[model samples]
Target: MNESGNPSQPVNVNEYDASHIQVLEGLEAVRRRPGMYIGSTGERGLHQMVYEVVTHAVNEHLAGHADTIDVTITADGRIRVADNGRGLPVEVRESTGMSAVERQLTELSFAPKPRTGYWVFGGINGLGLCVVNALSSRLTVEVHRDSHRWTQEYEKGIPISAFTRHEESSGHGTAIAFMPDADIFETTRYSFATLSQRLQELAFLNGGLAISLTDERPERPVRHQHLDGLHAYVAHLNPYPSSLVHSPAIGFTSENEEQTIFVQVAMQWNTRPPGEFRSFANSTRTHEGGTHEHGFRTALTAIINDHARRQHLISPDDEDITAEAVQQGLTAVVSVKLAHPVFEGCTRTRLGNPEANTYIQETVREHLAVWLDHHPNEAAAIIRHILNTSI
Candidate 1:
């Protein structure tokens, strides 16, 4: 045995040579370390695969190039995502000598190219569709664009069929279908309920964009389209209709001069304690929150305290209502769309943009104050409920 108390199978220092080094080409790296791209081999990672594909379609909707998205869990255990968007470019690239769609599915260096004045959540890591292609045992992409249909098939990121162009039969769109590689994932099965909730959330985040989820196993399909956007989201979060302090969720939308930053806010007070608070940056849920959430909480507490003092609900000598007290029964959703959003944390679940903080604070303070002034009865009820609950 070695002094380290090991197996002592071999002690050849020269054997640790350069030949052992491996250079994974194309999507090979993604197959080698799946977790680094998708987060895990568990259910969470499985869902992330769906998100990566869906987010691509959602980006099209965000860019005003698409309005409808469809996701299906096939009876054969495959997944399909389709969108009525400007389908992927089919022309060959001069630099790579490969069609744009083929390169996107086979290479890790290609990030999604959104049109100018638009923002997207995917492709930040430049993996995008390539990661999905690499991790899937089988993948097929169908594109309808410029009065023609293009189709390609892949197996574990390698092209198994020629890229074929056929006669045009429908409007422009993109569709992708894949079977998760059992060797790379702990399980290939998916939860329809998990997918439904997220697709519904996406529909709410992108108003007027219809998103549908179908499970071919049961042949059940559900669709979500919210014209009211975050207002609908806030109402959905507070399921107890009778417990609301306000009749409808207070909602507003604001944008900066360059139109680079857009903020949408919706909030409602409820009788229930520990109400939900959700925040998103460029359609990505900020689970851990960050500067935008901080700005929201700050503005909300200050406005409520100021209003309470003005109405003599609390004396000048009396202690101000604490932030915890203010949030006791508050349900709110804050969504910020930044041209260049900064995210932090290992999971990339927090917005870290400093400008987001200032913009959110000013926007919330201005809009919420106007809302309170317009709905004096609701404002009073909300404050009273907060005071009663905090006691």
Candidate 2:
């Protein structure tokens, strides 16, 4: 009791019971904290939802279950992604007692790791589709499996109708259509250029994985596809004859069985200004240079400096080639695939695995050394370019 009050009301501990602690079910938690799943409610987040969906289809292609994926932006602002893969299972999952399609759409923590060596997936812990479902105003899924067609519809993460079965289908695949929620997003319009660039990169990263993007909102629908892989990517970056010092980019792949990691690199020295270095881990782009990038740079600089010294291109007293000097006018793609990746954060823009560094460094060093020995002219040209930059 307070001194100034005659009596004070006793607090009732029983009032703060389990009933007061509300527990969110299934996608409800995702809707409440959408940013946690997709990064933001802004334009970037809006695009991420589309990417999440596309990544799944691409993963199927990587796993050898599919070869083609089509991404279309409708005139009505709906995004449609279709793939020619074994459709999502329509039967009920024993653990959850919900149909596989329903659980995949609604469950937040339902992502299972893909089979080792079959896929280099980049869908961010398998929560991609569930987040897309929670943030969309309307979503429809069609699956052609077991020679039959199955369909389901959802609105804002909840089922609008029961799963329906149609007559037997000739083909097998999965298609998803969705409209972004106006209440959760600042804008629903998809950027054609952004989608094109990302899809092109995906095509290059996963060789022969055909992906087509179409925009029906414009006067003439736009479509883009890449089939020649990273070689084509390097050629695109250095289009003119004068742009490339070396006619063809040197490309190679190396693997470490113990760590279950694979590394692929494509490199060319051009006549342009500062060059570009694109790096990836498990087919996911790493914009920020991490351990793998660091290792690559280290090995590249060392190899060039060693070759220059042996060829008498540089004086013994001259300082070793700096990373900046070695990278000048160079265009390179460094891609690594690992069974389990340790990324800097959920964004996965950087790799944190220490073993990746050692793997990449050794691979680049050993392979580049032999290539320099075999191609004296190209090696000399690269050394001359680096020498000019150092001076």
Clashing pairs in 2: none
* Candidate 1, RMSD to the unseen true structure: 2.6
| Best model per TM-score | 1
Reference-based TM-score of each model = 0.94, 0.91
Q: What are the Cα lDDT values of the candidates?
A: 0.88, 0.84
**Model 1 per-residue lDDT tens digits across residues 235-289:** 8999899999887998999999998889999999898888889999988889999
In each prediction, how many residue pairs overlap at the backbone (N, C-alpha, C within less than 3 A)?
0, 0
Cα distance off (Å), candidate 1, residue 70:
0.7
- lDDT for residue 258 in candidate 2, whole number 0-100: 78
